[model samples]
Target: MYVYDEYDQRIIEDRVKQYRDQTRRYLAGELSEEEFRPLRLQNGLYVQRYAPMLRVCVPYGLMSSRQLRKMAHIARQYDKGYAHISTRQNVQFNWPALEEVPDILAELAEVQMHAIQTSGNCIRNVTTDQFAGVAPDEVIDPRPWCEIVRQWATFHPEFAYLPRKFKIAINGAQSDRAAIEVHDIGLEPVQNAAGELGFRVLVGGGLGRTPIVGAFINEYLPWQHLLTYLEAILRVYNRYGRRDNKYKARIKILVKALTPAVFAEKVNAEWAHLKDGPSTLTVDEVHRVADHFVDPAYQALQDQSALLAEQQAEHPGFARWMARNVNGHKKPGYAAVTLSLKATGYAPGDITDKQLDAVAELADRFSFGEVRSSHEQNLILADVEQTQLLALWNELRELGFATPNIGLLTDIICCPGGDFCSLANAKSIPVAEAIQRRFDDLDYLFDLGDIDLNISGCMNACGHHHVGHIGILGVDKKGEEFYQVSLGGSASRDASLGQILGPSFAQDDMPDVISKIINVFVEQRHADERFIDTFRRIGMAPFKERVYAANH
Candidate 1:
């Protein structure tokens, strides 16, 4: 919830004005498609499979109720009546007229929002845990650091266009909810034995055609040197990273080729030149950024466990939702509530304009006038009182967001595959829907427990299929779409990439394929084990055999 200063306001306003002229030129044929490509991409406008898609940046996934209403208005007036929340926690309008994009951005500017750095080969949104400040297990509130990094990276002239799109993630919690290891730069705030706070920096982590967990480049980078160190890394990448091949241009590829130690040495040598430079963050500035994220006025109320228990006994549905969607908060008597977007029938992350408006109102009433969008494509009211849980649950149910399937088999992470993305080989939305329908049994789904089933339309890994407990990637087979399955991947503290499970299956056969895999886990699991735990315990052979036995 960082408020925009005069500098920030002036920057986006000017950017909007510049982009408006650029758009006008393109429409008037003064700028050809080739000429306008980088211009449009710099502003987060993409010419997708069908129409132009506009990705609006939501810094660290934080949105004020006012900003949320503005987005609803944009969706209603300029584009389609809905928006999609991407895995990166940015908002995408799937159907926007190319001519109206400038207008959309101008509207976004009014609310301290923009699309800059959201696309193109530049530093993207600096994401952190959606529950950054409120999580019980938090070692530090990462929002301030994320904001600091965001301020530094935004419009940085040097990194304006890297070899490929760059992403950075920060995690300050014990749980690694931010999936820091899967980003180009992952910053984990660690407290040393000497009581000083610094970041354990990881580099070369990505999940595209080549998936690799980030390596620890700097075991402990001091807080003061954060910007200078990042500058050093980017400088190295910009200098030697592959410019010949787009496929081999990412920092990860460079890191792999040079080896992490050599990369670290290069970064260290680069940092030697820039250490304690002007951009080095001061304690005062850290506090200045930190001031923006002060906690809400929390009441000194007792825990509502008894009241919730009574309600749970009365309504099993409420109990189910409480078990799945509600999360622990640092403060007593309060909890964070996730409104499910994976409600079986709709696209995984799609939220209608009406729902956006309603969520804004709900955030105002329940969560201190702010809402957080999670990487899982769900909206969160991060400070809801436990006493008001039932009321919130009832409203979410009416809105069709009270699906008790968080962390269950039905809570799928799916990309807008061939349906929207031109890069996609197969359709992911229908495949996700099919799997959701197949796993409709709530009791059965709960038994399956904490299974991350991610589906990507292609290997760009927008769906992060590489990190899912059950990963599904769409591949092209002789002009037809086939789904490839992978298992044992996780993006948690113990991060690892999944291994593929033999051959690809036709779209129609996906549901049966997933069912067989689940059956193997169900048969092999020990008491109280989750799908991931079972898969790790027994390995992939049993599941692979079950899935492909008939063909064999």
Candidate 2:
């Protein structure tokens, strides 16, 4: 919840003005398509298959109720009456008119939001755990560091155009909800024996045509050198990363070719020039940024466990939802809630304008006038009072937000595949919907337990399929769409890329394919084991056999 200072406000407003002129120039034919391509990309506008798509950055997935209302209004007025939340915790408007994009950007700027650096071959949004400050297992709140990095990277001239898009993630909690290892740069806070703070940095981890978990480039980078070290890493990538081939341009590919040790050495050598530079972090700056993320006011109250238990016992539906959607909180009388967006029939992550407005109202009514977008394609009420859980669930249920399937198989993570994105080889939304419908049984899903089912339209991995417990990727076979499935992947504390199960299957076979995989897990799982754990222990043989065998 970092408030925009006067300087921040001025920069955003100025960018809006600049983009407005660029859009105008392109439309008037003063700029050719080739000339306008990078300019539009730099501003987060993409000309998709059907219409222009606009990606608006939601920094670290945090949004005020006021800002949420602004988004809802923009969705209703300028584009289609809906918006999609991305796996990176950003928002996308799929049907915005090309001419009105600048108007959309202007509206976003008024709310201290923008599409800057959201697209293009530059640093994108810095994402983290949705429950960053409030998670009970947090070592330290990462929002400050995320904000610091965001400030440094936004409009940095040195890295305006890299070989490819760069992503950075930070995780402060014991659980790695941010999927840090899959990012170009992953920063994990650590403390030495003296309890002094620092970071454990991972580099060159990414998923596309090739998937690799990041290697530890720096075991312990001092907290004071955070910015300088990041700069060093980027400088090395900017200089040596491939620029000729877009497919091989990512930093991960460069890291793999040079080997991790050599890459680390390069980064270290680069850091030697930047060590103790003016951009180095200071205790005062850390405190200033962190103050914006401090705990909100709370009245003295006891835990409502007894009351919730009684409510759960009375209503089986509520009990099911409570078990799946509710999460632990640092505050005694409060809990974080995940409003599941993966209901049957709807595309995963799609929120209608009315639903967005309702969520804003609900956040103000229940959560402390703030809302969070989860990396799992769900909205979060991060600081809801335990006393109001029942009331909140009822309202959410009415709004089709309480699906009772968070962390379940039906709670899928998916991208707007061929339906919206021209880059997609196949349709992702329908595949996600098909699977959700096939597994609508709440009891069955709960029994399956915590399955991260992610689907990507293509290898770009926008859906983060590489890290899902069950990852589905869409591919084209002679102009026809086929789906490839993977297993044993996780995006949490034990980050690992999923292994491909077997040959790709037709779109219609996806549901049955997924079902067979689940059946194998059910038959082989030990007591209290999740789908991912069972896969890890048993390997991919069982899943492959079950999915591809002649008959069950």
Q: Of the candidates shown, which would achieve the greatest TM-score relative to the real structure?
A: 1
- State, as a TM-score between 0 and 1, how close model 1 is to the true structure: 0.99
Runs in model 2 with CA error above 4 Å? Answer: none
Residues 297-335, candidate 1, lDDT per residue (tens digit)? 999978889999999999999999999999999999999
> lDDT score, residue 75, model 2?
92
**TM-score against native, each model:** 0.99, 0.99
TM-score of 2: 0.99
Candidate 1 — which residues are off by over 4 angstroms?
Answer: none
Query: Cα RMSD (Å) per model?
Result: 0.7, 1.1
